[model samples]
Target: MAVALSRRTVAKNALSQLGTFALSGGSKAIAAIMVARTLGPKGMGTFSLSWTLAGTLAFVAVLGLDNRLIRELARTRDPRELERSLPLACLLGLIFGGLLTGIPALTGVHSDAAQALAAAGGFVAVSAPILIFRATFHAREKMEYETVTCVVEGAVALIAVAVALGAGFGVGGAMLGLTAGRVANLILCLVLYRRLWGPVRIEIAARRWLGLIHEGWPLAVSYSLTATFLRFDILVLAIFHPSAEVGMYGAASVILLTAPLVAVSFSSSLYPILAQAEGLDDEHLQSVFQKTSRILIVAALPLATGLTVLATPIAEMLFGSDFGHTGRYLALLAWILPFRFVNHLFGVVLAATHRARSRRLAAVALALIANLALNLMLIPTWGAYGAVAATIATELVIAGLLLAGIRPLRPILARPLVEGALVALAMTGVVLVTPGGIFPQLATGGASFAGGLWVLFLWLPSRGLAAFSATEQESAAAA
Candidate 1:
């Protein structure tokens, strides 16, 4: 009965994650399209500047409390710990939100645009504290609560933005909607947390909070690096180019970055299991790491292929000709999908193993340094295209470094790396040959690739191209 309940809970959590992504991805797409269609490139760029900075600031304020709470609570849920975290988190969040709203000049946007950017940035900070509650639900594996809250947030943002646009509120209006949505999201999450974990309180103890901060500081550094990498290209581009160029980059980015959302969801679902498996034997742990790496690599191939093939039509359809360059940017950026997939698996492994913190941090830190230097070298000459180049290169190097840290992972990566590349190549060929609108193209491309890969693996066993296979049950057991 315990095992049965565990399996059922895992299934529910996976479904809940998928639902959350659907809500988040869909809302973001709606918001992006609306911004592109209404505000044009320059306007979108201004918004992105504010929004990105705000995210960075919020990360600063949260101090990695979300992950820390989840990790500790997953170990053992103590009411005293929960009570302490609630107030500490709120206090830190308020401080961070104030910093975000207080500083407008940091974005380098000028005049009226700068003002709009400041408002957006402030709102983003205001919304970030809700993650503490979300993490609590995650630790308990009651993702259904967070999923509902996410949907409510997205729905509220969309309605707010639509209403604001109709009323001619422009960039500032859309930002206000996002901020308002965050409030609603926080309220819902807080209510749910109370239902499951009880009411919030403030019983702060300096020593305890300090200890919590010490425990989470590494996470803070790690998350900041990760978040910065995601937005670094744009931040650098804004420095070297016009708002319109930044907008175009932002447009492609909104879609390109969504590729990792699915991978993240998968890794996130596996995280608790892996964390709990720390005491397992070496053979079992090795098996877990190897299988997870393979799964993510294989999953990334078709996605990267399909998205790359569809980039042009999707970009044009979504943003029109003013943003035609976004397609090429996306195509070039598509390869990062596989690299990012591998890196996420590495991250979960690192987090689970618990000894890889310094190594992981060093690898990402090096990647960031390299990313910035490359952007400086390339962005001036190539603009948005340069940013894409930096992105692909940085992720590739980061994944390679992390893989090197996990000595046992090389062999696992070796076979799938070749297989995934070959599969993606086959997928690319099919997509190129079967030319049509989105649906027909996707259908033909997907079928042909799936059929071709199926045949290749089956008939050419000597080629060592046997498909990596794992049932969900097998993967769960390995974890």
Candidate 2:
């Protein structure tokens, strides 16, 4: 019962994180739509490229230390470690922030791209330290601070973007809005830090900092590669195609990419629990891993199905008519959601099992190389469609690699995947037949999938959803 309750607690925290992502992603999604509609394809393309550049560099600013910091804090509960890391992150932020600003200025791109990059530079500078604060909350399982900041940031972003677009500030203004939101989020996080952790410490030692970097460099490499590969297609697109085509791909990719955050939220909540786990072979760890895989499949399938079915209308409604092919791009990319979600779990599991340094890095390196090769080959011929193809193919390859490498997690996927597919197919039928807008289709699809799961798995004893809990309870009793 205690173990069951603990699992429930993990689920609760996961929900809180998911809620944070939902609100934050919602605001950003709206902001994206506003940018797309107001700016059209050319302007939207500039904004997308500029934002991706900032985000990719922000990974460098943190030195890929966020996850490692979380795991360490979860294990050690050391405040001094947190204090040391905060200043380091801020200092790196300032340095990388300069790089973000300088590159576009030096290259002499369009004024809009330059302004967007400059604003994004400010964003990186202000936002780097927030990562430390967020890791602290995540490791401690105190997500309410995150929740508060997410809401405030999202609201601020929406208002700022709306005001910018209203003022005809263009791509630069949209970028500034994003930076403004991050600034607010950073300030709020600082206040929360003081209130919860008591005071701010700003001491840094070079030797200790280098030691931390030494420990984190490998993870940094993996993370940077991961970030770059994910957005490399955009860079390629910008090179070979016009901004309008890039915008179409960007508009589609943004919506589909946000779906992975759901998996990240659940995995974040699970990480702390998994850190305390005995080993990869531990009974509780195995049970929870299987259960998590099941839950992610169940959550992701309906979303992927709905998006694939409604991609065209969603694209038309969100970005207006200028983005003619945006819906087709989204429809193709929607299939990646399930694979991406499960890959996120594979990563967390690898980290928890202490194999992240080698296996995970290898997997990401392979995928990154593949992505680059595929993009180079596909982009010139297929344009934006080529980028979509590369993304889907890369996800599938990486998912296979991760699944094959993580032996314990392999068997857990088959059942959940089979069940999820059936439910998704049923939901798709309902969605197709239902004669209404996207909202009604969404509602009915969700209802049918939910009803199908309950009836098939919960109501019927033959195919119970409680198998893991039952196994865990029995194991506990036996012990």
Candidate 3:
């Protein structure tokens, strides 16, 4: 009965995550379209660059302690210890946030509105506590609380941006609104976490603090470096290209990247389960990885295929005709989703399994080398497309290297690869027949996806797909 309840909990959590992503992703996409129209490419570019910088700084502020908190608190099952770690993590987050925000100001990059940037930085600095508190919820596996926090945060951010735009604040207004939303989220998360975790008794030990830092510092370094690689291209473009170009690239990237929400949702739902399962023997670990990989591939393939085949029409419908070229870039980027999805899953597995150091090293090295090479080779020729190419190349390298490092994960890779190819073929057939209109393209894509899923379901060994269905009592019993 407990096992049945646990399975149900996992399923419920997974569904909630999917719901949250659907809401958040839809809201964000709508917001991006509105912002793109309001600011054009240059304004969008500036916003994207600022966001990239802010996100990088946010990762720094986290110092990788978020995951540490989850692991330690989950393992220790000690609420008192978890409560104690919160303020310390927040302190570190503030210091890092201050440095991140201050560096740009001191360098005269924000020459026109240094005060506003500084204020923004301070707002971000205060955000660390919110982030740490949020991690505490994840540690306790309180998916409902986590989901509520995410949905509320996203909804607030979207509404705030719309209001800011309507009020004629433009890009800066949007950023301020975003910062405000984060602050709101931080406050809400703290209140909810306290209520959920019960009254907090704050205590700290130097040894415990150092232990978390020691475990998390490498992850922090890995996260920071990996973040740099992910966002460095935008920074490069901001330096070399016009803000309009940056905006164009940024807008298109946002649209293309939206597809990964499905993959991310799956990973987020499963990571805790995997973390708990880590104590099991090797055979059980491998079984979990295999089943998880199959589920991930099954979900990712059709989504990627649909995006690739319908990229142009989807882009136009979402962002308007003004963004036609951006649509083309989105199309090209669709191809990377399968690879990115695989990378995301394996990367989580690596981190959860304590191989994060090696994964981080490979990721950083690949990102640096790929960014330099791609920027030099493609940027002058392809502009934003060049950046996309660079991103794809870098992600592939990181995924490839990480897979090499974690040999145990290799056996699970075959099904996803095959499934992806089959879905691509089916999507190609649908695209060839579908006409130009938006509704027609969407219908065609939807039909293709449904048909492809049916075919794959019929063809793949039943054992592989069975693990995904929580209601299959017999299969559950077998597992």
Report, for all candidates in order, the number of backbone clashes: 0, 0, 4
Q: Model 2 — which ten-residue stretch has the worst lDDT? A: 1-10
- Give candidate 1's TM-score: 0.87
- Give the TM-score (vs. native) of candidate 2: 0.92
Give the alpha carbon lDDT tens digit for every residue of 231-271 in model 1: 88888898889999999889888887666776777667766
Q: What is the TM-score of each candidate against the true structure?
A: 0.87, 0.92, 0.85
TM-score between model 3 and native: 0.85
lDDT values for all models: 0.75, 0.83, 0.69
Model 3, 1-479: lDDT tens digits are: 01122567667767767766676566656666777888777667767776676667876776778877776676676777566667677777678667656865578775323333554565567667766776677677776776677677777888888998899877666767677767777877878977977766667666678777777887677667777777777877777778777877777777765778877777776666566554323455567567767766766767766776667777667766666677677777776777777777776776666544565556666666776788777776767877888988887787777777667556466776787677767776776787777687677777877777776655555756666565587777988
Q: Which ten residues in a row have the lowest lDDT in candidate 1?
A: 1-10
Clashing pairs in 1: none
lDDT for predicted candidate 1 compared with the true structure = 0.75
CA shift of 313, model 3, Å: 2.6
Candidate 2 lDDT over residue span 1-479, tens digit each? 11232857786788888878877777777888899999899988998898888888877789866767887887788877788888888889999999877867688765887888888898888878988898888878887679889999999988999999999898889988988898999999989988877888876787798888887777788788888888999999999999999999999878876767778888767877777765566677777778788878876787788888888988888899888699899888998888888888887777666554567788888999999999999999989989988998999888987887677655466777788888888999999999878878878987998897787556765545478678889999999
| Model 2 ranges off by over 4 Å | 1-5, 108-110, 456-479
